[model samples]
Target: MDTLRIQRMNMGSGLQNASGTDKAQPVGDLGVWHVPQYMPGYPTAATIWPRVVIIQCEGDVCPGYEVTPELGRGEYLFFLPTRK
Candidate 1:
């Protein structure tokens, strides 16, 4: 048997106005970082589980629809035993 999990996480950031010339960058600094507090319409969860962690940043690219990382944000999807 195999176990799979799908979770939607919002890091909390507003969409920049289409007119702005300034490009948006990742919302973090060198070392530690924080997720945005308020996101309209979406109710903030009282208890936040910090188990999920971002492992690495592969790279950035423009993929027709939008600019997204080539490998995307790496994080723990779930745990599964190896099939033998």
Candidate 2:
């Protein structure tokens, strides 16, 4: 199976939720990177460029979501590969 990847990125500070709550779920002393939902025509477990917000730290793997790059810090891409 193809695996999704994610790299920690510094957003200059902590991230917040829509309800004005701080996403400070420390993963090894790091805050959470709250990803945006509602990317039409794709699985909830994946993300694409320009629509996804880049943030720091390898956050907790969301139930139906996944990160990309599987490496160092920067903008990460999330996508699901088709099986043949």
Candidate 3:
């Protein structure tokens, strides 16, 4: 339920990424999958109030779309862009 809401928010948020694209949006239509703490490359143990998605997940640290330069490199949010 919350994940669905997040997907909607991701679309309506109308944000972009470093390359001037909405690629940070979720990769699933109705699912927002975050990196689990038990996962090998868990980015952070902080709260989930973040705006980001895995841009490239082939590394130890997944690069995410930084909603702002100051949000740091933590890519915790995951969802598919509803606009697509």
Q: Candidate 2 on 1-84: residue-level lDDT in tens?
A: 112223223322223222222332222222222333322233444333332333333332222333333332333323222222
In model 3, pairs of residues that clash are 26-79, 26-80
TM-score of 1: 0.19
Candidate 1 local Cα displacement, residue 69, angstroms: 19
- Model 2 misplaced regions, further than 4 Å: 1-18, 29-41, 44-84
User: Which segments of candidate 3 are over 4 A away from where they belong?
Assistant: 1-44, 48-75
Candidate 1 collision pairs: none
**Collision pairs in model 2:** 5-67, 5-68, 5-69, 6-68, 6-70, 9-56
Question: After aligning candidate 1 to the native by TM-score, how far in Å is the CA of 63 from where it should be?
Answer: 12
Question: How does model 1 fare in lDDT?
Answer: 0.24
Ten consecutive residues with minimal summed lDDT in candidate 3?
Answer: 4-13
Question: Which candidate has the highest lDDT of all?
Answer: 3
* lDDT comparing candidate 3 with the true structure: 0.34
Instruction: Tell me, by TM-score, which candidate is best.
Output: 3
Mind giving the per-residue lDDT tens digits that candidate 3 earns over 2-79?
Answer: 322221122222232112222232345544544322122446756555444434333222333324445444444443
